[model samples]
Target: MASNVNIEFRKLFINNEWVDSKSGKTFPVINPSTGESVADIQEADEADVNQAVQAAKKAFERKSTWTQMNASQRGELLIRLAHLIKDNVSIITELNTIDSGKPLTASIGEVLQGVSLLTYYAGLADKINGQTLLSDGPVFSYTRREPIGVCGLIVPWNFPISILCMKIGPALAAGCTLVIKPAEQTPLASLFIASLFKKAEFPAGVVNMVPGYGPTAGAAISNHMDIAKVSFTGSTEVGKLILKASADSNLKKVSLELGGKSPNIIFADADLDYAVEMAHQSIMYHSGQICCAGSRTYVHEDIYEEFVKRSVERAKKRVVGDGFDKKSESGPQVDEDSLKKILDLIESGKKEGAKLHCGGKRMDRSGYFVEPTVFSDVNENMRIGREEIFGPVQSIFKFKTIDEVIEKANNTHYGLAACVFTKDLETSLTVAHAIKAGTIWVNCVNYFSPQQPFGGYKQSGIGRELLVYNKILRLSLLYSLQIKTCKIILYCLTYSMKFCVYEMI
Candidate 1:
């Protein structure tokens, strides 16, 4: 862990105040690099979640400060919070790295991305507009968008700071108060940012943080009756459970950004070196904990052998050590369970007849570290190719033509994202259009922008994140108003309708 990194905010944050959990229980925050306890954070259970939701509900009342604030004012607060995050980038990066086992450089990049999201949403706050309609009657009609009251935001452990900003940016801009539940494994960064919310002068209870296990606090948020909507970023299995909780409770609106097994296709006409490096980084970044990591790579048969050779050498040379080390290219897995699952999946790949080109075993060290592993001769039937292996493990497959590769890429149940690397513009366009993923990167991988919307198709996810102007509208209610200035009544004779005349009064 970094010497300057301090865990200042440990308790639950509700209504702009830090307090202990109702259960008075705490959980250990471990440093993955050394596998030791760094701090014990206050655990939030169902009772704590209730308190947070109540606070948010109060803040969302019609007469509350958050409710009465103008769109520009809300935008200003987001901008202020963004500036505060920028002012303390160093400390926030350190806290994120220490809590999530991500490299310091990557953590810094995520923090800046978060700032960009906040700024983007701030700029869009006052720009949101509704529509006016013309009806067949003598009445004027127009639509007004209003907030949906309290919301529950569930943040995953990976890329904590950035994802938090991604959710809060639009939600706050749309005047929706929130009760946020940061993942238990990595809550320090979220809690630290909660302090900045107060510094930004956001109204009390507008944004709250409650850190605890998924079953307790997370479930409570999904099932809370007062919460009008829930936005979650995590696994597909858990996403289903959250949807069920919504149905079982208040039927709150739910948006999920779930798991993925993204495919990276490299054609023979492409720049082989760039494709190989991008594919490698796509999976190796943050130890491949990202949901949209390109775990499956399909190479043209003409360059398959050479690509595998280079990828294996690259994996072997990757430096796996503490995240704080300047020379380390990769860091430890988030925890022991994650390490074991990755290792188990690696073994399954071997058993399923995939050729292990290089690194396979776990790195013998103090913390939960695994070697960057690569496999070749992969097929769609193998577990490595079928499942979302959220680790630094690459599975490479060979393809003969564009049609076959596209079929292979779309074969997975998950369709979050995909990548195509080729010099031929026609081929690139064809593959990009043919793939069934939400985001298709042409000649690139893992590229993200705040202006672009990101989500998935099939079983990957339900809704998009970023490009939040319309998404924020989805979090609001639409009301149509019609006004009539004059009333006219028509009278008709019933006995002799054929010859009778109608009179207007």
Candidate 2:
């Protein structure tokens, strides 16, 4: 294998060793914050993915220490890794800022979020138990929540570390091995994080990361027959492609946390000042690259002009610059593609007749910067309202009644999250129930913990992550139970007996 690329990172972590890409191709990990190359990583193609999967398959099939170890022991190891992360928090923050071009504060918060997840799952590792159901016959039935073998997880360029922990901690805690495909743009921190696991002395092949493009490497992992589960976090179009790939292969279990154009609604009764502040944060956090960003804002018709003016002033005050800068409120989008997409949307919004309040132009200097832009008089049918821009721009609409606003918000295919700001409990409760998103925040925007589950209701995605209450639907295996003096209702090669049951919600 090639020695560690002194110019950059040399190897992709496979089977506990840093090995060069099978193809011997190398790519630079560019710092979007500075528009400079910071590190180099092996650019793995399909062949590299195959090697990673084979190692993961071997690790799982051999009943490796990761699978056979006691849950408590695994949890303890996870806690150790979490502590390791705590010590190197500043390094992680800097890496994330340089890698994905988001503010260092946001990256630091994400690193902490990841650490908390590891610690939380560490406590939960031994708690994943299968429950027994009271049966009528002399047959005992119970469910087993066993790990589903090698998991192929693909994380996005945004929020790399936190999402990585979300996928890694749960799967490992449940006794599964992994083959991760980090986004090609932002793979540095994950590589370092996985290296920390090596420092913590995890068994070989328990977790392998291959940094490569989505089409070849990611497809190779999804289409691997030995992979029993697939977990992905990305755009809506890509999520569907993953589903198709999973179905084309061994029909592995699939979980997706996809795109969103979430709504933030402000009733006239809301705290005006707080609403204005939240409205600014709803789209500007992480440069509005967040998947659950409240990109679409709705205000009551009575307070529309006031909300717009205050929101515009607040948007104007946002300082945009390099993420490493201490005083920067907003940073550039992740890379060039993200910046271009945001600019295109801004032009389209102006053409579609939505009045640009401020920040319609890109920054004249530096790497991949867009002004925190806002659009007003946005119609529900406009592209700005319907599309997921994934940038530092938000489209605002005005509505009169709670029911009407709910209808407008739910009209989109993406329903990842929604936020409502109101002091009246009755109106909040009524509006919260009606807003058809996976997560609804009352007087808050993007409040997530390691304990609370987050997903979507519509085309936003499939399956959830970080659910505290264990609702795993594990089906019981027949051979493990003892059946005695039970009615054998086997109708082989004939019509089966009819069964019917009624359930209430």
Candidate 3:
């Protein structure tokens, strides 16, 4: 176990300075594995949120250093941040493990993935460009790309640093300033990364981070009129509220990466052993807290019974303990509330007629640990089958035909990601094409890459993230249009006196 995992930063970061919340309130940050308070983070209220937005707005002004700086320079700073993250991977992994209740190895992988993403975005900073439009003689018109001013970024608790990088990388590369709000349950790693942002020498007010509950700090960011856009990763319920808040306030551009009830389909013709192992990793990793987790598993009826038996055996072998423990394959839920919710979902599944195969109880420990659970004979209408449990509870269903399974899989309201395991290329391609998810993995699970765009279908989300090249280009075009509109307005007003101006009678 990593013994040096401790809370380092507790203050809110604004204008490149560490400051306390204006409200003078604080909240305890707990380690889910030990049930111990790591530290008290300064809680930002509406007033502090206003301060952050103002700071970001200042930095995003045309004359400010952040907005006026060279694109290559901005990209260089991101590269520096990526290097710093690579250097401090151990500390980051430890902090995330303690705060997020993820196994040490998993935390390490997430940190490294974050590093890769940041580096990838850094390389694209100078490549944001626009094209010349076709025009007649004496008229030359072209498109120019630029930043979106100030952005409000809300990151979720699970995979804190990964999601943070996914949002901030593009915003920074596009020359936008930011006000970031990390989830209340896991804010330490984000604060640590903010320190690195300062170390990378990003201009003051270019990046700000506030830590607090959703109703206050999160709501404030969503409703702040000065924020040009908001990028959020969390529950679908909260995502909807953010949309409403944006409508009520500035009508800012919004991007949401919300909840999922992703399905994993296994065909009888496929390799059952490899499929079982991958499926186990899909749901049990991080105790199934991943937003794109394969919570629902559909196996061909021919191999459904054998799949369930093997899956239960594997679940029984999982080690549920502190995240810092090297031998621990899975850790606890993020907190007491999450533990309770997971337990409730498990019980509901039992009452809903899903047969409990194994592991439907909590571990005998102090932390918020739940057993690695598996249930069989689950139907689509069951509570566990329909909702995102967000824990180590796996529900298995039987399917006879591809047509029937495709309809059942697409029936969910969420469609962030899905996976299909089959040997035949035709079947794999058919299933992959038919699934309504934003991301589909054929014969694999939980696969992610920085170059590929990640988002959801329907209620899953609105836009994409980590879309390396195109995102920066799109943001640049939007920014150019905004600036041109302002210039046109100014030019028209300046020449208004030369034309016949009629006043309202």
Error of 3 at 296 (Å): 0.9
Candidate 3, superposed: residue stretches over 4 Å from native: 468-505
Please give, for residues 1-505, the per-residue lDDT of candidate 1 as tens digits: 4647778999999999999999999999988888999899999989999999899988988899988899999999999999999999999988988898777877888888899989999998888777777777887767667666788999999878889999999899888899999988899888999999999999999999999999989998998888888999999999999999999999887888899999988899877777778788889878889898889999999999999999988888888888899888778889999989999999999999999987788888888888899999999998888988789999999999889999889998888988788777778778887888888877656666677687888888777787454444542233543322111111211212221000110
Cα TM-score per model:
0.93, 0.91, 0.93
Please, what are the lDDT tens digits per residue for candidate 2 over residues 284-306?
Answer: 88788889888999999999999
lDDT tens digits, residue span 355-453, model 3: 998888888888899999999999989999999899999999999999999999999999898888887877877887788888887766776667668
Worst 10 residues of 1 by lDDT: 496-505
> How does residue 133 of candidate 2 score in lDDT?
72
Report the lDDT of model 1 for residue 487. 12
**Which scores greater on TM-score, model 1 or model 2?**
1
Query: Which ranges in model 2 have alpha carbons more than 4 Å from their true place?
Result: 1-10, 468-474, 478-505
Candidate 2 C-alpha error for residue 328, in Å: 0.5
In candidate 1, which residue pairs clash? Answer: none
Worst ten in a row by lDDT for model 2 = 496-505
Query: For model 3, what is the error of residue 122's alpha carbon versus the real structure, in angstroms, after optimal superposition?
Result: 0.5
Model 2: pairs clashing at backbone N, Cα or C within 3 Å:
none
